[model samples]
Target: MSRQNQGNCDHQKLISETDTPSLHEDANTDSGDWFADMFADFEPQNTTDGSYRGTMAKIKATELHYQAVFEQKLVEANTNLKRERIRVTIKQTGNSLQLRATLPLKPGDNSVGKQKKQYDLSLGIPANLEGLKTAIEESYELGKLIARHTFQWNEKYLGIKSREKQEIKTIGELLDTFEEKYYQTRQKTITSQNTFANYLSVIKRNFPLTHLATKENIEAIINSVQGNKKNELIAVTSVLIKTFNLGFQLDVKRDHVTPAYREIPDDEKIISAFHMFEKFALSRKNTNISDEIDTWEMWRWVYGMLATFGLRPRELFVEPDINWWMSTQNIDHTWKVNKNTKTGYREVIPFVPEWIELFDLRNSKPLNILERKVEKIASVQNINWMRRDISRWFRKVGIQFQPYDLRHACAIRAHLQGIPIKAAADNLGHTVDEHTKTYQRWFGIENRKKAFGEVISQRSLIELQKNEILALRMENETLRLEVEKLKLLENV
Candidate 1:
């Protein structure tokens, strides 16, 4: 018989032998004999009770032998090859084949690490040996074509359907699509929109949209940049991952990629920065009485607002709608955070009454009491620029500090004042655990020890009270029993 005709007979025989009622009844006998013959040269390390498992083992061994023979032929065909190899495997699904072709690295490969990767091609093919052999040969040829282009394979090369080809978009193109979807699907605040725009700009600046979608390019870009620039690179990579995930929902083929972030330690200690900033703010208020009082007062309010409310620097100056600031009839009472906050909406009351007076709430349109009319609503860039000016001022006064340090100072003050950790976190619009992790050192060892001692003392007192209650109960029971006996004796 021809190989194709014999394969057809074998397929029919396999289905008949496995599924027929009479064969199933005598499966142990018939299948064991069949598997023993098929795997005569192969030995199974572990024993199986059923004939089905044994048959499967024999089939697996046969497939491995077939793959090994094909691999040996490829090796013989290419004598000087070092690392490249063709791996063929039949899918367990019974109607598919898989081919993996690894391309050897060139002498000057610019990949970050020396890891072997391959181009995989999967095809639906018949289960018969002859059909599998033909599919494997076709896959080998296709893999060679892919390798010749340095593994930059695309759907066009494989002649995939147009629908499938449309899914294979470059990373940059997918990001643009993702950004469009983001604006359409999400209700973005002005701050959020600005942040998204910045992320898009950074990604486009660093990566070309025309390049193929691969993680290796991301790695190379990250490696090419160093120092502070790496932070921007990592930020871009993070946005890319988010964009790709969004693209996935639209059937785009941009896989997620992660770029490693450099872990640079903070040099400015929170407590030290706080003290220095406080002195600077106090000096501004105390020293200049005549010409610069307005300027000094503005800095004072800025410092006080950050320290008192833990407000972000930009929050104080963001577009001055009524939502930005709220106050009660008096400056001393708790105020509502009427606007959208970074960690969602939260209310923060000042510790001191003077903090609230920093805002000119008498006017229907709230403005900073110290801000000029023209400067009432400052842009985010101007806010940041002012913060830099404040930093320089601190240096001129022989202090090292930034505007953000005041917020940290607020957290530390909250810890020192014996505020409940959860309450403090809520006031700052953060979780208790996050608040603790960020400012645990500022809480001081003595505070931690005091907290620990209080807990231990409370537990000890509870145990002592429990013991006393138990002893009293026992005494009362004894007295009751004696009284009952006396009553019985009197009745006798």
Candidate 2:
């Protein structure tokens, strides 16, 4: 054997003799001298200061150890390749490693007059012991395929999508790349899909395709918009910057405000709207069209649930568990929001418990109608469709208030009924601070007057009682004086 081959064999023997280092070092173990035994001749490479100490030193040691181990693995791989039809080898570039296969062409079938063609298939694997093992296995598999003359340059061998790299020259192309990468790392769900849709909408609406995706261009696009739209643009643009590592910071100040809820309808208006819906549905019942009547009633039920439960519009279709609350078998009326919801699983109580009976919510779920609708729609569209449909229906029925007005109205009602902010926030599936910020802004003149009026009435009643007590005391004193004077007169 050559001296180089002998050195590799000795290195392999030395590694086998000692305890193999784990990929993740134990936290309790001393970080210093942790890889000391494994890499006695460790030298620092691609590091600043060139000191064998601290976290950087440990990382350098680990990298060098992985290199040594990979070299030993390559020696074993070379031995295995002796009997294989294809010449398989390991190729390392920076921190990543890949397998290169040289396939022999058939006689008189040379392309470009070459006897063999080498293909470097990048698996995007780390240059660690585990990655080396995977690459060696892939090489053997490739060898088998080449031996059978069935080898082709494809994802089957490359371990990635077999598509030509598309050049991203414009913001639009960059967004496409970012979108694919964004979804690829996440588990697809109705909420995530909807979130992506909203993000893409904002990005596409604000950013022009002609502009290059640079730090200056992104900032310019963000600066052009104002308020919440500016904040939204910043957020989605930041995703692209981060995903692509476009060395820049999104330090622009956010639009510091929440949507104004002061125009939210009062309880009287909300109740009035429900009554109008009830009237409309009653009017529809005489039309002799079952579907039309069912639609009206179903919508009325949705309105009632929103007002009674203070539920978000999307939560209407999310099917938050309230059957137990509605069922006669259970006494607890606390509804459970689904785990898949934006705020996740939490218990909620009816803000207007009496509204349940008033709206006939207990007896009228319209379950069959909702099930049919949900069945026909795609899973991702389930919540979105419900929200839009309810909004359209409300407009068609000539209701002045939006669907979320009911939720805002419910929040206000909970506050008016002296519900603790924390308790209300918990029921609403948000923080106490968020609940305060949202509802407090909407606690306008009307709410303030109602609150102040209660205190004023109580004060006035107390003042009247004190005046009456003073008059009674004076009368008693006068009667005592008259009685005493009469007794003296009689004695004389």
Q: Rate the local accuracy (lDDT) of all candidates.
A: 0.50, 0.66
Cα-based TM-score, every candidate: 0.43, 0.62
Across residues 1-492, which tens digit of lDDT does each residue of candidate 1 receive? 999999888655544432334312322333223223332353322221112343344335545654454345334323312112323332323343444455444335566775555534445343333334444455445434443444544553343643363455676677756665343222344444555666777777888888765666666676677765665676457556544442221222333435332221122343243344446556677665553444544554455566567766555554433333444443444545434333334457664344454442234322344345326434444544655665665565454455655665566667756688888877765566657754664545654676678778889999999999999999999999999999999999
* Steric collisions counted per model: 0, 0
Tens digits of lDDT, candidate 2, 239-285: 67655545468768777755654477887787788878767766666
Q: How accurate locally is residue 346 in candidate 2, as Cα lDDT from 0 to 100?
A: 67
Q: Please state every model's RMSD to the true fold in angstroms.
A: 21.6, 14.8
TM-score of 1: 0.43
Which segments of candidate 1 are over 4 A away from where they belong? 1-179, 204-213, 223-238, 241-294, 319-328, 352-398, 441-492
Stretches > 4 Å off in candidate 2 = 1-169, 184-187, 256-261, 281-292, 460-492
Best by TM-score: 2
In terms of lDDT, the best-performing candidate is 2
Q: How far out, in Å, is residue 455 in model 2? A: 1.6
What's the true lDDT of residue 241 in model 2?
A: 69
Specify the poorest-scoring 10-residue window by lDDT in model 2: 46-55
